[model samples]
Target: MGNITETKVYMLDTNVFRYKSNPRAHKSYKKATKRFWRNVLQEFRNGESVLYIPKEVIRELEVQSYTLSEKENQRIAQLLELIEETVPDLATPEIEHQIRKITAYVRSEYKSDINAARDMEYGSVSDARILLAAWQYDCIFVTANIKDFMLYPLLFPQNESRLFDLLSENYVIIDPTVYENIHRDPVFAGMLQDLHNMLER
Candidate 1:
């Protein structure tokens, strides 16, 4: 077991939970994803790492769930229940302001980026809220939709140094694919190993 003081914290994006709960997802991939989440929950229960779900993310999921079949909706509800039991929903007064600011800035300034434009058009502003929460908590932000989150720092040239500082301190934005293939991804493997070493110390 890991030391409590050395516990790593993770803030999950909506896509992570959605993909896990997706009924049409391939059986093998679903199995692997469930195994991955089970390990994460076990670690959380052991006080090895913290897991969080932003209120905005939950809102997005809840909105989407209405369109899904009853079975899929139940799956999402169960997943939400598990997450709520594991960690408190994060919210802050600044979150609304931050989301609006991010959406407007990215839409006006980085309009050339199609992904950013589509995210804005599709009302995935949850990304901005989730990012704000991750920044507030200084936790690793994990997501399946990495492009949107990865573009956050690049939008502001003035904050380049601040963004670099966060990256260097290991307050990183990670894609779940990295964890799924840690063996082939040296950077991912190294990060996880470092966390393990910290806990051992």
Candidate 2:
């Protein structure tokens, strides 16, 4: 057999885990969702890729878990255990500085979109912190909340320009929907294949 290939590192968002915990919630695309997660977990199991979850994302999941039904809470507990075994949690003192920088940038650039008085609220900083963690680790930031993250590249044009210059690079953001459609659509498969190929290099 040929040598085993190294794959990209994926820094997962909270929504990705939420969907993994309850793929049936997306009944219309249940099969596709299941296949997507199966492929992702297989990559991890095969040692092709490393998975990371920011500490902030874990905190969010823990908070959300408390509101779930007993069965769901048990399910989440098991999932968290699996994640603890398979994925490394990203945490550092410098993360706070990055979060502050991101918050300042967002507040300044999107001032009209946010309530200035409430800009410093707790919930407002989580996403920024997540993105900063992904950026810091140079991982592929995977999420279901695409629109929210799409703003990052636009907000920081210099980074976008740098990313374009690097033919095979990291810090790209992707949506799990790409995986959800992989079996039914050639386009989705092609997109994932391309990412896989790039990461392997």
Candidate 3:
């Protein structure tokens, strides 16, 4: 609470990963997230914190990472494989159950004896699933999905979205705006270069 440094776990999303490849998204936020990522590596080097990727997040980002850089593409592949070995899959029964339970609860909370949700307005099931992962991991859902995640709540009056605050408290979900805080540290400098050099060999 007082010190931001207390946040030890980070659950990233595809949108956050895509920022490295998509300059347009980075430009919108003034390239803050890009810089933060470099910083994240630096912190990781410095042992500031631990980075844990939900299996699904890794799968989701791989498709995009390949388009960005030969190194990034390859790196994503390696990460995914490692994650597969560890968690093996993203959509497990527990995750699905969590998604379903959250959906049902949210639906009930949104229940009005007035009207039903329109197909277009209700959005997709994927939204709930992503939210579920963030909740379950007790980590932030780091995403650049401004239009969908951030702005959508404004459209609904009783929309009940502590989505950002809720996650920030439990999970520290950094948007492009907050990434610099996540990554900037005295820690990540030569560690990554050493890793790169080792990998090259």
Candidate 4:
């Protein structure tokens, strides 16, 4: 296993996959973002990183299939096949244990609709179970659905930290924009350039 310093294992949200294949969300997305998808996958191929996804996430995505062309669906299929190589097969024994315990706790403690907001925000039963699993695994919650989980940091004030801290609290919910700005950010780009220069010299 690689040290935490080098490889940041990220739990990808469903929308990242969706945004790539389905052109329905953004009117101009297909024409607009040719390079964006390329860069994200490049990071995956190069980073020596683990792309962890809860089985639930994949199941949900698979079930919620959108209308797309034969070519687009075929592309998504091929992409998933490649991604499967890098995605760590998590959500195994520990996830099963956590889900049982967490479900019991939530059903016993929270039955009212008042906390339903939080429940639904976290995607109710499965999500609560998944978050607990994320905590156990010590991975960042990489998601385009930031709004779905932003309440996490707010609800648990102690979980707050900067973007760089991947394993701070329960999970670090990285927005898709974080990947978008990877090489474009002046600070990080300059640092990368300096590192490159040092390595070359």
On TM-score, the candidate that comes out on top is 2
Weakest ten-residue segment in model 4 by summed lDDT: 161-170
TM-score per prediction, in order, is 0.54, 0.55, 0.47, 0.50
164: Cα error in model 3, Å: 6.1
Task: Assess the local accuracy of residue 126 in candidate 4 as a C-alpha lDDT between 0 and 100.
Answer: 54
- TM for candidate 3 is 0.47
Q: State how far residue 93 of model 4 sits from its true place (Å).
A: 15
Residues 53-155 of candidate 2: C-alpha lDDT, one tens digit per residue: 7888878888988766677667666656645323334434344444444445444444334323322221246775776567656666666554345434432
Off by over 4 Å in 2: 1-4, 29-32, 84-123, 151-201
Decide which is better by lDDT, 1 or 3: 1
Clashing pairs in 3: 42-188, 139-171, 140-171
Which sections of candidate 3 miss by over 4 Å? 1-7, 24-26, 65-130, 146-201
Model 1, CA-based lDDT: 0.54
Estimate candidate 4's alpha-carbon lDDT, on a 0 to 1 scale: 0.47
lDDT for residue 176 in candidate 3, whole number 0-100: 36
- List the global CA lDDT of all models: 0.54, 0.52, 0.42, 0.47
Instruction: Give the range of the ten consecutive residues with the poorest summed lDDT in model 1.
Output: 159-168
